[model samples]
Target chain A: MSSIAKKKGFGASLWDYLTTVDHKKIAILYLAAGGLFFVIGGIEAMLIRIQLAKPDNDFVSAGLFNEIITMHGTTMIFLAAMPLLFAFMNAVMPLQIGARDVAFPFLNALGFWLFLFGGLFLNLSWFMGGAPDAGWTSYASLSLASEGHGVDFYALGLQVSGAGTYIAGINFLVTIINMRAPGMTYMRMPLFTWTTFVASALILFAFPPLTVGLFFLIFDRMFGGNFFDHTMGGNTIIWEHLFWIFGHPEVYILILPAFGIFSEIFSLFSRKRLFGYSSMVFATVLIGFLGFMVWAHHMFTVGLGPTANAIFSVATMAIAVPTGMKIFNWLLTIWGGSIKVTVPMLYALGFIPSFVAGGVTGIMQAAAPLDYQLHDSYFIVAHFHYVIVGGVVLAILAAVHLYWPLMFNQMLSEKLGKWTFWFFFIGFHCTFFIQHFLGLMGMPRRVFTFGADQGWDTFNLISSLGAILMAIGVIILVVNVIITIVKNEKVGNDPWGDGRTLEWAIPQPIPFYNFKQTPLVRGLDTFWIEKQEGNKEGMTYAEPLSDIHMPNGSIIPLVMSFGLFVASFGALYNGEKDWAIPVLVLGLAITFASMAIRSIKDDHGFHVHKEDILKNEGGNK
Target chain B: MSHDAHVYSKSQTEYEYTRRVRREAMRGQVTTFAIMIFLTLIAFSAVAAGFSEYFIVPILLLLAAIQVVLQLYYFMHMSEKNHGMAAFFLYSGAILGFTLFLTFLTIVWWN
Candidate 1:
């Protein structure tokens, strides 16, 4: 109720965060949770590398190795990368578009809690009995044969989290479509906002297939359903089709935001307008559309018939045209501009050739016959890491440095950031580059260990050493974060001094209601345009300052997510535990009761009066 | 002042025009509802009349598709102005769903 800025006690702050529907606080929650999972996934990766560091090594048992790899892939993709990107999207997208908040703030909170609880439930598998060992894909035949409840955890946990992702996707789509400030036409929207729009569209269309596939898996395992039971006239290939249908678009959903982030960085540091802006937008939408048509490329080795393979092969290769257009666009963006070799710009410069390398390998695999040669080998492994790590991971590191000032009113050490970049970049290439040769040398992927006679000893050792260097880089990053937070050196808005968007126009330590008055975005890079026109405020007010309506924080989202979390355990234990049915019913009842209460209660959100806004502005000065 | 809601009194002519438009919309909705009921009845009768299984099934599907279009346009007011984005998303979802089924039929079930 207090409109003026005031510090709260620790418990009060904690309670505020727990009930917050504010996009900024929810973003911080996502960052912290996603960072935790990133580290966990990193540790799992290290375990993989250490186990493979030497020939015939037995650091982890074979079974545990499977579990580690599965968790690493599932956790990194579902929990770490996607949420980290969402963290950025939540933090910056609304600001870029000059919106006060996302369309559904309550659903936004629910999405975060659902993801957190789902991730928690999935990780709990390690302690409960075992983790899923059927690989991240969890192919039906393989998963159906796997013992214990590991695969069940995989299915149900993803079901809960995927729903969250789906909701978040719809939320973003709606927000971008409906929430742009006055004079901010669709064509005038920043590249980051445009890419977010397309990425959210991909998520909206893509996630339903995953939900359906996961449901099929859940029912088959838990309720004696025979959807995947080939012995009962079920076809196993259907799972492959469903999983890839979702999985292919899932990659785009991760990468498009990455593309958006890099596009922002490239333009910001270059001190120039994005090169071929419309084409960049065109390429993004093109990639999103093409993303759906080529899922079968992943299954070229599955003998989906020569005709099917040929059609998909051609479609897969066609994606490179748009992707290549993007690469050239970024390069041209940096060409002849007053480029600042800042940490983010450094990553953007590094990303071009690295992503191209990944894309070229992708084209190679698009040739169905060539894929047969590379399938299930270290080559396939190398190709994905190149795209994902080289592209998305690099963009993530860059955005961390770029948006650190925006998120927290402080700056990370520039020196430490550059050092982290070099170490990580070099380490990444060193780790995956030789894997191509190793794959060509006939070494396979997912094998726990190889014998000395396989001629892969030295390369595996090098790959492991590279992984160690990457870990050291990450450790340095963690140290950098700690140092930054502890120092808490406050920064002003436009900390980068070359900010090009509306986000940088806001005051430092941004208020909960982001913009006091909605900004009139005259064109792309609106802040830059304002700066060029000698505007001191870096903004043009769309209207006079007025009362702003803001949603109240609520705990219903957490309770609802908890209901699903509790229900997952019940479903996991069904047919085996005596109380499973009761637990299931109880959990659903809790969820439904919370829903009823939410619908019945009328919460007309409070408004900050113009008088309070004036006082707050004075206090800020 | 910006937050204050302003109540505007419409001119008599404007009020009459709005009333006529609403009445026309209601008529359209009622007519569409009747047509949807007729389509459903035809589908049900086709099933009950012991036609060839293939003939009945396709006809029922066709009728169902028509009913869906009517439902979306008339009942859901998708034909109204300002529903462009909603319509776009709905059709996109339909197209994507259709593609998935077609792919499934060709690749999974047929092969």
Candidate 2:
């Protein structure tokens, strides 16, 4: 009954988070869960390096190594990188557009819980059975042959998580399209919001094919279906086409938002308006469109014939045009402006050359004839890591440093952050750069070990050393996070002096309902415009204060996600166990009954009265 | 956040104009409905008439396409002004789906 700050017991706080429908709280949930998976994936990476450190050392068995590598790729891409980016998106996008919450708050919570449970179910594979040893791509040819319950876990877990991702994607699309505040036109939105919009659209178009492919995989593996079995009048290549159709855009889905993050960092630290803003937006969209055109490039070596390969080859190389434009736009953004080498700005500067290096190698491989030579080689490995780590991971780190204050009202230690960056940046190149040459020297990727006499020994040793350095960097980051949380030093709004978006304009400890009065977005960099015009309040309100209607918290989303989690286990054990059918039925029944209850009950939310708002304004200020 | 609705009374001319517009819209809807029914009957008769297989198939497909457009424009109100976003996304998805199918046909199946 009270709106003032009241510290509750740990149990109450735990329950609050469990049922919370607030976007900010959901964002925190995503951050914590995604961060946990990042560490898990990092450990997997370290294990791989340790195994590969010295030739034929046998730190891990070959089968376990396969599982480690597969889990590393799967966990990093699906669980760690995408969800971390989603954390920033969920935390910042609505605020950037000046919306109180996403268009669907309950669905937002459901999305996070679904993602968490899905990740948990996938990780549980390590204990229940051997992890999925087929590569992260899990091509039908390999996955269908793999014994044990590992691939089953991969298919069912991804199905659960992918649904969550699809839902989140749709939620973001609707929120961006329909929920902008008055005067916040599409053109006036921040780069992060623009990128989130494009990425969500990519998700909308991309996830369906993944869903289809995973279903075929599940059916082929668990049921007696032969969708990929050649003896049964089914072709395996269909899986490749379906997977890459989803997979290729999935990379764009990750990196475009990374581009958006760096765009913000570059402009913010340089204290300049983004140069060629329209062109940057254009390039982001162009890249997203072209993303769909180049899925065939990943299949060039699959023997689709010279004509198909040539057509796809050109399409793949053409993506560089927009990407090159983006690189130059960042350069121009930093040109002649007051560039501060903050941790984030440092990452942005590091990103340009690193991503370009990755892009060049990518173009080299896009030539079908050349890709035939590089296929399944560590050179291919180097090319992707250079982009993924050098691009997406770097952006994730920079955004963490950049947005930490906005999210938590406390700043991460700048010195420690810079330390983490250097180790990570150096270790990233050191780890993967040599692998390109190792690949050329005939070291195939995903191998458990190589002979000491094969001339790859020294390079593999160096790469493993570099992986250690990267792990140290991550460890330092974890330490930094723990320290920041423990200190909990409060900071005021616009902690970054040069904030440009609406997110930075709100008072510290942003209200559960963001923006008590809807903000009037005049133009790009709306906050900067307000500050320059000597507005002490740091925003121009479009409307007078009024009672704010907020959705009530509910446990339905958690229960809904948990039901799927339970059902996944049942589905995973379908033919193998007697209890599986009942469990599956019970789980579906739980989900459906809860859904029916939700539809039947009318839970109109309460309003925060105008008097309550005014009372809080004094304390917040 | 007051939820009170304000009621407005139309002038006599305004009321007449609104009524005329609604009547015209209704007339247009009814005509479209009749045309759709006539097209369906033609399709059924053509099938019932036992035309050559090739001729019948193409005609049926063409008629079905026409029906889809008519249903979308008239019944679904896709012709309305505010449906631009919906239309854009729908068309984009359709094009993407077509492209995927074309790719599969050429590379995966045709070979």
Candidate 3:
């Protein structure tokens, strides 16, 4: 019995993960996949820096350079950062709310597989012909003019992946809304779960526009439609409208979770309850609400005229108020409390100043006239990297360190973590901060190279050097991860000793079924409150010991996603191949067959009896 | 099981009564669906006939807005639970999205 319960061999573990429908395991899959993409995107960044290291460099061809930059942006934002945040949310949120699993476990597995296969299909373009060369936005006129299958790949890949994201978002919404533990009121939920709820709602609303836009693009390119062909009585500006409507909220979708992470860190390390919790929640929802209103701020340079510009500009500025409320709340969260300078706290502290700089620049761009000069310039690039890297990426790194023990029962070495933070932080500043000045000096973005006499050479070199430093920092982080996993040093619940959320209330390795009995959430920071009241168990259960129902793991989701993967290839080759139609039909049949089977089958899940629970009580501990 | 059978039947009867009440609550949704179908037909007809294209577009858009409300309230089950707050959030997003589209169209096309 102990041997069966102990660690299995490699193949056994592999099989377990391959068929696992557990949300936590799915989170690990997202992390692993997202981490791979992050590294690939980072390498692309290095290539970009190398090409621009000196003025008039010709290391990479212009077309190829465009492909690299396009993939870098698209991959980082969609594939790396968002999924990594999803990883954290999946790993923690259910535990926070004291749910055994997400609302739809099968759908969760399908979501991960769809994302994986879609990303694979997109990157396969590199070997098949070429990756997407149009900028990540793939603005209509330019994309329509571009040759080869690059834009086609972008549309199809994003459509598949975007559908997956939409599914995951809806799942989070239903899970958070309906599956909360007894006494876990909306107001009493942890900030991260709250942000996940709001961000998921944003995703639910934001992604449909992108889906519609991608459909239009696909039809125009592949199916002989003229939605974007201006000469054929089609309007190109419609594409811009559709993309930004999705694009603007996409930014908030990425950053709001970063805000949630910092909120948790501030309260935890400072040993203080989050100040003005309700107001912080209010601000988050408000920012998400206002996010959809300001899409046209990106169109100031596209000449939407004064009335459109002024309305969007004002609406864009209004977002700053809610965001400002959050900043003050964080500062107050740390005020007059015992502060600890952990590696995560360092990133949180660094994020405040860095993200403020990014936020202010965003406001500056909100001024319509000012943005006319800044649009498509290095300044816009600098502003977003500060927000994305300085804000979101930093949060990912911090959460990796902070939540490592919670997720994997191992702690990343603090010594190495601090080293990673400094190098990456300094490198980030060096790389992006100078680009702001470069933009001010009349440098346009998305250019392969610049002329030497333009006085941009030195800054470009410095930026390239900075990129190398950031790479080193990432290498150190990888080393830390390897070391921690190999050592496998165990940590107990509340590993930080000041964790304020329910996620930290569970012991390490976090049993396949989290929370033998659901915890009764009392108030904001319920776990923290329980700790203050001297509860060593770290929770107060709402229910007595009883049999717990658990859904059986299934491989059907993988088969379902694989069917779509096959159909995507068929769709891609529809006109080119003789067998394409048959393949498409077969693939779709597989998917529908699986769906039919799932719908008709009754899966009354088995229960872990009370005696089994007693037997396993101290196993994880 | 033997002793409780009578009580179980009584509870089942009560559940059937509640189910009937729930079905009655869905009468509003039947009307909503009918109205949606009617509006969609009108939109297709106006666009197809090409009559007063300018005025027809606005009328069509207004009807489309009504259909959106019907879908939200009826199909999405938003009417049953926390209806006020859910409606507030959904409508706010819709209004903002519509405003963005209109503002862009006015500035870029009308101007």
Candidate 4:
């Protein structure tokens, strides 16, 4: 929370990050961890492509391939995409609404550490035994059949991380609901804030089902409770129902924020107010609501009967209406005003056509009978990749380019950015576009290899080549990030001059307490409104400057998360190890002790007095 | 804007406004308690009476739900202003949970 500039040693910086409760700093933590996992998942993806590149290739055994694929999906969805999106939400949403900080900054730090520990625990499966081979969904029948501790890692790790995700969701919900500065009404909130709100709600409702499902997985595997054991009168399909019930909304939980990022980009870069802004809000919430009703669509091939299938199919397709509303609104937003094709905007432009293709395929799969053909095929694979990659990944990348200055006070190389986008975009279409055809040509997904005589070799090679191209693009992005960080050339507020929101209002090197005085958010694009009126300050204060009360940083969150990480190992070896029970008890004691200390401690936190503030301000501004 | 001066003696009108609001709140709580007790008694009698299991089940569920709503609105004070966000989330969670339950009942229970 230090506003004063200082240079510190590496160890001091490390210690600061480890204990910091600041939202902006926490965003950096998420970005660093999620980026590492993203690279891990990417390597896993490349391995998968390589194994399938040529017919009967022995790059990886079938068993190892299953492990790789399972980890890739689980890591990308849980560890990478969601956290990256969270990074943006943490970094920008509070600023956008003109809040000094999030509602519960300590809880925010707790969420990050919990996620990090959980992800570490899960990935440790590679050395502990083998990784989960039952796929990311961890369907009960397959996961129960899995012999090693892989599925245990998947279930327990997700449980821990999912709890963190749920906590973060609640934190954001409370922040957005209560912490808006004077006059920042729900209707007046930026689309990103609105989308974060809806997405948090989605997380609130969606994650419980996953928790229940994972608990079932854990009980069946570790405790021998037979929640999904068919012999014990438990039905495996019940797991599918529960998983998809959570799983479907989880998709929206990822995409809606991505949509928010794109919406911000379209409006800001195009120099226009977001078109049909209310409808866009409506669509976001509508998408979240509709997201729940369509879980059964994923289960269409699971034999839920014709009536169930028909209902779910139609409900799933009905979602296209609100989604179509969003797409058209974006098209109309950039229709007339001004269009600047910056890196983020270029990605936004690329997104429309790519996501539409994905949506079209999604509708195709929504048709139950058609899904009968496409389900578990490479086509389904292509369809989801389009949506997740083209929609969410594009948005994350675009936002990184867009908000880098805001987060780090440095700009990424835009010249290299276009090169990254084209390579990734072209490579994305090349890899997945052919997979759709492969699915249509009777090629199944999750296959380690195919017979060369089947005539799938050419398409497989082409897709592999495309994957390599995509890898090159990601590597370039890494290089670009390195160059930018090394250069660290400082940039000012509203780095893009056509800044539209309150996030753009603050000056370079954002103050520890974001707004020195809580800004009066008059309307949508509040800072833009002030800037239009020639207010160089880009804001009008709701109140006079006063002493600011701020929370002190604590290391309890890391310790608490580490407690769970230790306990997970104990749980993993339940009856097999004699020390397991004692270990579990020890871990629980540590966690509870930390909690007790947090509760009993009387740290009221210090405030910056007006004299010190005025002194700091006297010579600065 | 100092806290010490802002906490200085309040005017008579401000005290009267606080008194009126408290009285209204008290009355609302009393009425809600009476209604909740009545709903619970009805739930018990539905089980006490000899009726079809289906009839008793729906009746008990309905009555229980009504009581829960009362508890949230009155006892928990979610009905009060500034709890709009709370109400939205409560209803949203309820709708999603109920939807999941119904889907499970329709698809899973049948098999």
lDDT of 2 by residue, A1-621 (tens): 123568999999899999998888788888899899999999999998888888887899999999999999999999999999999999999999999899999899989988998999999999997899999999998999999999998999999899999999999999999999889998998999999999999999999999999999988987788999989999999999999999999999999999999999999999999989999999999999999999988888788999999989999999999999998999999999998999999999999999999999999999999898999999999999999999999999999999999888899999999999999999999999999999999999999999988988889989999998898888899999999999998887888799988999988778888887999989999999999999989899988788888899999999998998998888889898999989998888888888898899999988888888887773243
**lDDT tens digits, residues A439-467, model 3?**
89888999999999999999989989999
From the highest DockQ down, the ranking of the candidates is 1, 2, 4, 3
The list of candidate 2 runs beyond 4 A from truth reads A1-3, A618-621, B1-18
Q: Which 10-residue span in candidate 2 chain A carries the lowest summed lDDT?
A: A612-621
lDDT (Cα, tens digit) per residue for candidate 1, span A1-621:
133557899999899989999999899999999999999999999999999999989899999999999999999999999999999999999999889899999999999999999999999999999999999999999999999999999999999999898889999999999999998998898898998899999999999889988999998999988998878998899999999999999999989999999999999999999999999999999999899999999999888899999999999999999988988998899898998999999999999989999999999999999889999999999999999999999999899999999998889999999889989999999999999999999988999999999899999999999998898889998999999999988787899999999999988778778888999989989999999999988899998888999999999999999999999999999999999988888888888888999999999899988887777762121
Q: What stretches of model 3 exceed 4 Å from their correct place? A: A1-4, B1-89, B108-111
Candidate 2 residue A239 C-alpha distance from true site, Å: 0.7
User: Which residue pairs in candidate 4 collide?
Assistant: none
Report the lDDT of model 3 for residue A272.
Answer: 92
Candidate 4 chain A: minimum summed lDDT over ten consecutive residues — where? A612-621
Misplaced by over 4 Å in model 1 are A1-4, A618-621, B44-49
Q: Could you give the DockQ of candidate 2? A: 0.47
How far residue A469's Cα lies from its native spot in candidate 1, in Å, is 1.1
- Per-residue lDDT tens digits for candidate 4, residues A1-621, read 256677888999999999998899999999999999999999999999999999989999999999999999999999999999999999999999989789999999999999999999999999998999998888899999999899999999999999899999999999998899889989999999999999998998889889999999898898878888889999999899889888999999999999999999999998999999999999998999899899988888888999999999999999999999999999999999689899999999999999999999999999999999999999999999999999999999999999998898888999999999999999999999999999999999999999989989999999999999999999999999999999988777788999899998887678777877889989999988998899978899998888888889899999998998888988999999999888888888888999999999988877877676665541122
RMSD of each: 1.6, 1.6, 3.8, 1.7
Q: List the residue pairs that clash in candidate 1.
A: none
Give the 10-residue window scoring lowest on summed lDDT in candidate 3 chain B: B1-10
Q: Give, for candidate 1 chain A, the lowest lDDT window spanning 10 residues.
A: A612-621
Could you estimate the TM-score for every candidate?
A: 0.98, 0.98, 0.92, 0.97
